[model samples]
Every structure is written in C-alpha cells, then in structure tokens.
Target: MNYTAEAPAVWDPEAFTDAEDCLLCADQCVVRAQHYFVKGMIEIPVIGGDETFSWGVWVSISRDSFSRAADLWDTPGRESEKPSFGWLTTDLPVYPATTLNLKTYVHTRPVGERPFVELEPTDHPLAVEQRTGISLDRVREIAAAVLHAGEDAQR
Candidate 1:
C-alpha cells in the first residue's frame, strides 16, 4: 500500500510567500535555502501479510547532508551511501501524540524511488509499529482515514 504526502506537515508550498527562498518539489524541498528536506517512505510491514503500508514523509536534513544527497541523486550506486541522520517532519494523525521531530535515518534508494526513512526506536506508537508491524486492519483504518481526509479537502 502506498500513500504519499505532497509536502511536510503544516507547510503549504502553495501558500509560501518567499518563493525565492523556499523550494518544495515532489522529491526534494528546501526552506529559506537553509532548512533542507527530502521525501522518503516510512514503511510498516503487515502482520501475517506479505506486503507493507507506507507513509510518504519528509525528513529534515542539514545543508551539507542535502548537498551530499543531491550530488548522489543521479549517480549510480547511490544506495550504497551510508544512511544520513535527520528529523521527521511529517505529522501522522493515526497516532495520538505528535509525530513531528522524531529522530530518523534516511537511506537513499535506487533510481526513481524515494529514500527509505527509519525512525529511531522509541516508546511512541508509530515507532513501535515500525519496529514491529501493523495489522491488516490497521492498514484499512489508515486507508479509510486518508480517504475521508481527501474527501474533506474536496468539500
């Protein structure tokens, strides 16, 4: 299952005032040319199922880190690069607590695929779910939530 976010939580590229300073594309983002971010997938394996459920999220990286990732973006064997540390910028609504600012590691994937984001082991429900796995029912719940959210937006 693949559900992706268009941008980081609470940051609207459409409403951004400083167009010159902020950049938000489908895969990469930079705010004020200082705060750098990259889109990645945080996948949760389905219990007793062969597939996975993923949240298309963003991770905030440093300027140097972003530069390194950018340099390797189109280069072959970029997946061989070590995972870069960053903070999770997406806010997931499925959990009660805020999902923002969690520690994470972003691993570059092969060409045409977004990076993979692994959250730091923590007591948070999302982290626990990532460490372990979620149920098919959980996936249905997430799907229903997302569908309703999209419907709400259209209203």
Candidate 2:
C-alpha cells in the first residue's frame, strides 16, 4: 500500500530562480507574495485497490484565499475553511490534451499536509479520473508515457 510517489518539480520558469519577484519551494509558490499558489495533492482513487495514485500539483489562487490559508496555516481546524477557486498550473504531459488552466477547487487540509485540489467535473480524461477514480493499469500507462521523456535533455 505504498503511495509515496515522487512529486514532479515545479516547471514554471519563474520558480527556477532566486529572484525576489517569485518564491517557489517544495510546497508553495508566490509572486510578489501577492499572486499566491500552493502545491496540493491531486489524488485519483485506485479502483479495486487500497491506495490512490496522486500528483503533487500546484494551482494559482487569489490573494484573499492565500492570505486566509497563511493565517490558518499553523492553526488547528484549518480544514474547515471553504474551498477556493484556482487554476491548475501544473502541466501533466501524460494526458493527450493540455492540462493547464483547468478549473479547480483547492481544499485546505489539516496542518502538515498539502491541500487537496479537486478538478472541475469535465470530459477530459484527467478530470474524469479525479471525479471517478482510475484503474491501476492506467496509472502505470501514464507513468511510462511521460516520466522519462526529458531526462536526457536536462543533462
């Protein structure tokens, strides 16, 4: 029942630098500390299995939502806050269609966990998987298709 898959590194170029305009860490990103974002778990249930297949992904959220999340970040019961609107900023290459800018509702989890990002119900395969879960075979297929494509180019 191992579910600790490696989350992809942030792909946005602005996050690559030590510049003052942006901040990108293991679990959060901020621009001018105003255009805020946080990495969250996009979990697709595994059909007939014990664990979910997940993508640790980032989303662009509003200033207000960001502020509220920061305020309650260390506080207990932070999970009670309403979900906030966000745009899926991560581009998952395994999908046939582009996965960026998709609508999402970001749910804050308790302290010590990433937020859960719920994709809007749509016909897109990724969104559908988020809503209805995916088969384990499909997860393997996706992993095989995209996981190693850029390794050589990076070096």
Candidate 3:
C-alpha cells in the first residue's frame, strides 16, 4: 500500500477532543491536545519468497514525546526506556489494534524537512488497522471512532 494521498482531510479539533475526552483532564495533555499526524507506508519482506507488500500507516504524537523518546534512544546505560506515547493506526490485515509506540523505529530530517515515521516489524497486533492508502479523512474517521469508543466505554 503505497502512501499516495487519496484526499485532503482536515483535522476536526472538536470531534477529536470529544472522542478523546480532552475535557476530562484538569490540565491539557500533550498527547491529547498537540501531536503530529502523518501517513506513510513500509515494505515487508516475505519468507521463502521474493514478495513484499507495501503496508500503509497512520500515526500522531506530540513533539515533546518524540523528543523525549529520541533522547532515551540516544542515552546509554539507561535502566528502561519510556514508550513514546501516541496513536499508531494502520491499514494492514496483520494489524488490528490502533495503539502503538510512535517513537519505535522512527525517522526524521532537519527542521525544514518533511518528517516520517516507520513501523517496526513485530508479531504482535500493535496499533495496526486493516485498510489501504493514506487518506487523512479515513485517519480522522478512525481516530474519531476509536476515541469515541473509548469515551463510551467509560460511561
């Protein structure tokens, strides 16, 4: 699933906040209020065959979390690394859940350059969703649904 932009999708702050329940907190949380949304694809190698599939991915996270995670990635002799918190939704059959560490296997360039995040190969269904292409509208819809589901679960 190559990351070709299907259509432009605007961020609905109100819907996102409602689904994420941002109002429940006394103070603003970076993960809920501020984060980077991105879409991309990864090539997966198949065993015993010369075949590969382009897996599309959708992710969002705050700069603070990304920086903190990057610091941890560089730090030596660290007891344990903190998982950079964020949303990791995707369009792959192997992945179903939409919760993942946004910092895992990430890549980026200078300030003026475009940022991209790569998903690490894992057997666990971590932050994976069954879908194709990179549609901001689809991403927003999924986020809304997931967050809304969370909100409903709490009620």
Candidate 4:
C-alpha cells in the first residue's frame, strides 16, 4: 500500500501531559522504529554544514514522495540495498509482490534550529505560535501528568 507523508497533528502542549508521554511517544515513533522495528535513521550532511536525517516513516506512490524518500535513503555505493518504508501492491503469480516496506524520511531541522518548525498540521492556535518561537506549553503540561501517573502507577 503506497502512502504519502501526512504531517501529524502539531505537537500539542496539552496533548503531551508528561515526560513519560513525551518519551514514550517519541520512543515509539522514532527510536523504537530504528532500534527494534527494522527501520533506520540515516543522516546526510548537506552543503552549509547542516545535516539532514531520514527518519523512516511510511511509503509513497509517485515521484514527489518517492523521490524525497529516495534522496533521504541515498547512501554511497549501496543505493539498491537501502531500506524500503512502504510497499506497492500488484497482481501476479504465486510469488506476487504483495508487500512493500516503505520508510518515512522525516526531515531534520537545520543546524542550530528545531525540526518540524515548518510542518505543523493541526487546528491548535498554539501550534502556529510554536513555529514562530513559542514554546509548547501544552505538551509540557501533559508530560507532567504522565510523570505523575508513572509515579502513582495508576490502574
């Protein structure tokens, strides 16, 4: 199933009520994907001393997404061996291509800047501000709650 990069909801301050939630969500979304789920994070140094990283996320069907994923997945000498983040479906014989592993190439922030600053997808007004230097208070607040929950070990 080929897919496209749909920016996730803006990181809500309230949505992340505690550190545990932040850590857990981030861990599940990225670290775990790389460490245990066979996905990988590849970093490439761009001209300006800035680096771009491909945090494999999903797959695509067209040149736009496919090209972007390909650029992110690019590495010297072993382009064909790069990982696949999504799959394409096709009808065929006994060994049809039923599955295609797609990888999400999440862009990293420019040097000394924050990542995802230009890609906020939500109705939250705070998200707008966040792109312009505002801190994510809602996420911090939720992170606090997550920590408390962990401390109490609620049922």
Candidate 4: Cα lDDT at 90: 15
Candidate closer to the true structure by TM-score (higher is better), 2 or 4 = 2
* CA lDDT, every model vs. true structure: 0.89, 0.78, 0.41, 0.29
Q: Report the backbone clash tally of model 1.
A: 0
True-structure Cα RMSD, model 1: 1.5
Residue pair clashes in candidate 3: 1-54, 91-131
Per-prediction TM-score:
0.93, 0.86, 0.35, 0.26
**Candidate 4 — which residues are off by over 4 angstroms?**
1-71, 74-117, 120-123, 135-142, 149-154
For model 2, residues 1-155, the per-residue Cα lDDT tens digits are 11222322344464546667777677767765556787898899889987888888888889898888888989999999999999988778778898888899999999998999999999988899888888888878876665565565476
Candidate 2 wrongly placed segments (more than 4 Å): 1-16
Candidate 1, position 50, lDDT:
95
lDDT of 1 by residue, 38-114 (tens): 99999999999799889999999989889999998888889988999999999887688999999999999888889
Best by TM-score: 1
**Candidate 2 lDDT score relative to the true structure:** 0.78
Clashes of each: 0, 0, 2, 23
Which one wins by lDDT: 1 or 3? 1
Residue by residue across 97-118, what tens digits does model 3's lDDT show? 4334433443443333223444
